[model samples]
Target: MRELPEIRFLTSGDVTGAEKSTAETAVRSALAGAQGTVTAIRVTLSVVADPALPRPALAQAIVDVDGRRLRAQAAAPALPEAIELLRDRLSVRAAYLRAS
Candidate 1:
């Protein structure tokens, strides 16, 4: 079995343990399609202090596959929504890269 790539999580504001864990799991699951090509993954999540913003939660990720890099970002009113959006974006990008 191929080993999973190293995943690093960075957070700002009131990020929770569950959010980080869920983000990690989502990234790992998405990378399954890309598998051995991945070298590392970095996930960043943050919550905006301002309450006026329509989308206060932000999530982004950078995936290093071999020597190539793939990136995705999303914003939502809730952290979980941003995480899921980022995960989906990453998954699509990974699959596209894997194909070519």
Candidate 2:
């Protein structure tokens, strides 16, 4: 069996443990179908605060596959949504890579 990719999460601002776990789970599910195509994935989550209200969370995902880098970013009201969006983008890229 092929080895799954290593996932690293770098978080900033206010991030709860549950949020982190959700992001990791989303990434894992996203990559489940492309196990052999990806070697490592790094996700960065940034929470920005505004004087009036809190801004949406920003998530950036970088996937390393065969020495090539695939990146995607998303901003959402919730952390999990942002991470899931990034994962979805990566999944699309992974599919293309597999086909090529």
Candidate 3:
């Protein structure tokens, strides 16, 4: 089967940042590695200040596959950690989506 189509995400909304490429690459990597057919996918991310933490903000990812959306929100001590959490979360979501 063909690899699944995926739209990755990142801190930046547009496709011009590490996070964007990171998100997209992860999905594409996951789907491609599994040899699954891709229908459609979209991932969006936003980094905003955290009102409660007195920090820059948090990283939130909203992913859409076909007609379903998977949201992963995490507040880590750092952006890298947040991305890691998001990756794990998205991975689980992708697995779930692929199964059913």
Estimate, for each residue in 11-91, the C-alpha lDDT of model 1 and write its tens digit: 998999999999988888877778447777899999988999999999999988888999999999999999999989999
Best by TM-score: 1
If ranked by lDDT, best first, what sequence of candidates would result? 1, 2, 3
Pick the lDDT winner.
1
Task: Tell me how far the alpha carbon of residue 28 in candidate 1 is from the true structure, in angstroms, after superposition.
Answer: 0.5
> Model 3 compared with the native: what TM-score?
0.55
Minimum summed lDDT over a 10-residue window in model 2 is located at 47-56
Runs of candidate 3 with Cα error greater than 4 angstroms are 1-16, 30-57
lDDT of each: 0.89, 0.76, 0.55
TM-score of each: 0.93, 0.81, 0.55
Which of the predicted structures, 2 or 3, would earn the higher lDDT when compared with the native? 2
- Model 1 lDDT vs. the true structure? 0.89
Off by over 4 Å in 2: 35-37, 51-55
Residue 53 accuracy (lDDT) in model 2: 45
Clash count for candidate 3 is 8
Which pairs clash (backbone N, Cα, C closer than 3 Å) in model 1? none
